[model samples]
Target: MNAEMQVILDQLEEENLGIRKKAIEALKKWEYQLELEDACLLLEKAAEIKPLCEDEWDNPSYALVTAACIFIHEDMVPVIEKNILRYSLRAAIKVLSFLLVLNTESAISLYKKTFHQFYDHGFACTGV
Candidate 1:
């Protein structure tokens, strides 16, 4: 992994949830500058850390999803798709919903990919 990805993964493993949450939030701000592979890797790591609270404020998934939105390329969509069902469905919906807000060509492709995944999983796009 690259230095940034290492930092992200390390943060995910931090004992302090505050530190991990801040790191994830910072990653979101830096997402556009990261390589697509690195961003996807970081998201994977973020997803592995279970949420400590149901509220978005305490959940790292919010940050992870926001970060993922920045690099929603066709190639990375599969990575997100593969892990969608592994994490909290509510969290996945929150992240994927943010992805839909991105209007870039890559974002549109990811939106379709994610939409299909949610639909296949029996989630209603309209409600989530």
Candidate 2:
């Protein structure tokens, strides 16, 4: 809703993945606070953007993970964790790595939860 948020949202909507990734990084670094409604709106808008084609260097998955890393409130961690599991292990690992860099406690908790879920389902990581 603020001018800064509007600009960031605009950048996220840009056709170039680089621009969107930059915007996501900036948003993460700035760590701006938003009202729940405003944050949800921005996240919804971000979700509308399509993922990049295979040839694109800047993957939208990075932005999505960055956004989740930056914007996840304490109450939203469970939801984000659920969403993370829907992604490939590589993608989930990348996102969890970022999350760990940003907030270790939450990241560890999510990792434990995800690991349990996977183990219960007979899923296992194939490589070290």
Candidate 3:
């Protein structure tokens, strides 16, 4: 990763949520400059962070997911599938859109599973 990418990655660990959100925004703005390695790292980090909001704008993790989707690869599928259920509906939809484009068959299966999971179980963590 480049120095700039490393710095942004560090910002994700900051105590201040605003800083983390800005770091994710910076990643989006610098998407063209991100290598596959950088995207992979960002995706990993982003997936681990809980979203700050239901809307994508205020959710750093969701924003990062969208940005990372630009560099989507076959290897990233597991991460995407594993994390989708944990995301807010809006963010999950955004992720599902990318999955659809990446691999329709898997995406369809995941979509069904996600829909069933959400419909049957609801979000236990969010109480929604």
Candidate 4:
């Protein structure tokens, strides 16, 4: 990996959650350049880090989810599904966006299956 990628990866390993969140945000800039190995590494790290983020003001799950989408890997769905309900509305919307980008038919089917769940989870509001 390049020095820039190295730094981001190092940041992701930091004990400071804020630093890790910033690292995820930084990964967004590397979307087009990320190799498969790097994307997988990032996805693994993000999956591990995402569940630890509990603060509403400092959540990194959204950035992590978007980074997975940016990588365009087939593995994104499981990662998204694992945490969809835990994410804030903003992050859940990102899940929907990823589905739309993946396939309309699949998105429609998944939406049909989960629409009630989403509504029951209090995701029916229009306001962001």
Candidate 5:
């Protein structure tokens, strides 16, 4: 991961909406400029964040998830896990559905463990 990317990610927690926005944009730019593995690490870190607000537009976690979608997908799984409570239930579901499209196995497993009562019966984790 780029050291500069981590620096910008730190700004996401800034209370100033404008500062977070600029930081989000800068991180998004790195999606194009950085190598895929480094970018993935950057985005994964972003996903680990929990936004403080419900405003999707100003929520850096949401912005990071959306922006990182273009270059990173698998890393989003943990993001959904960690930040599920930070967002409203609706927004949380939306992000999960998006992850399902990107990586179905991880998303479904996460969904089952968290929400599906039958999940404990015998739904297995498969490579497919």
Candidate 6:
């Protein structure tokens, strides 16, 4: 990673929402030049960080994750899959959906494991 990009990555940890948004934008602008590892790191960080939700429907984390996922190669699927438990049922659905569009095989491979939690959560009323 370049010095400028490193600085932007550091900005993700800033307490100020505006600074974080700016940093995310900067990284997006530099997406073409981002390394796979750097992109994965950014995606991981974006997934871990809580979004600033001034507007109820708009989530910066979703946008950041989607954009960051663009630069992440298929080889990093394991790293991302391992973090599935960190996501909510709804979030895991969205991530799985996103992955489905990106790579059907990989998404299907993970769905059985990842969606089981969601299925179980919804089926708690039933004895199944």
Instruction: Give residue 24's lDDT in candidate 5 (0 to 100).
Output: 66
Number of the predicted model whose lDDT against the real structure is largest: 3
lDDT of 3: 0.66
Number of residue pairs clashing in candidate 6, backbone atoms closer than 3 angstroms, sequence gap of 3 or more or interchain: 0
**Per-candidate total of colliding backbone pairs:** 0, 0, 0, 0, 0, 0
In angstroms, give how far residue 44 of model 1 lies from its true place: 1.9
Question: Candidate 5's residue-wise lDDT over 1-128, tens digit each?
Answer: 56776677778877777787788677546445556565455445544555555555554554554545564366557765665544433344455667667667887787656555225533221100
Candidate 2: residue 85 Cα off by (Å): 3.3
Higher-TM-score candidate of 1 and 2: 1
Model 6 segments more than 4 A misplaced? 2-4, 27-33, 52-60, 87-94, 122-128
In the predicted model 2, the residue pairs found to clash are: none
In the range 1-128, model 6's lDDT, one tens digit per residue, is 66786777677667777787787677556645457776566556545755445543234345445555664467556756865555433345556676666665776687666667658766231100
4, model 1: CA deviation in Å? 4.2
Model 1 alpha-carbon miss at residue 17, Å: 2.7
Model 1, 49-75: lDDT tens per residue?
Answer: 676554565556556656665645556
Summarize candidate 2's per-residue lDDT along 33-72 as a digit string, tens digits: 6765565454344335554545443444445445544555
Q: Candidate 5 regions off by >4 Å?
A: 27-56, 71-79, 87-91, 112-128
* Model 5, TM vs. native: 0.52
Task: Output the TM-score of candidate 4.
Answer: 0.60
lDDT measured at residue 78 in model 2 versus the true structure, 0 to 100: 54
Lowest summed lDDT across 10 adjacent residues in model 1 is found at: 119-128
Q: What's the residue-level lDDT of 86 in candidate 5?
A: 49
Expressed as tens digits, the lDDT of each residue in 2-119 for candidate 4 is 5786787677667788787777678656555466666555445544544344565444545655665674555555555555565646656776766767775555566555566887
Ranking by TM-score: 3, 6, 1, 4, 5, 2
Q: Quote the RMSD, in angstroms, for model 3.
A: 3.4
Top-down lDDT ranking: 3, 1, 4, 6, 2, 5
| True-vs-predicted CA distance for residue 103, candidate 2, Å | 8.4
Where does model 4 exceed 4 Å of error?
1-10, 33-57, 71-75, 124-128
Better of 1 and 2 by lDDT: 1
Weakest lDDT window of 10 consecutive positions for candidate 3: 119-128
Point out the higher-scoring one by TM-score: 3 or 4.
3
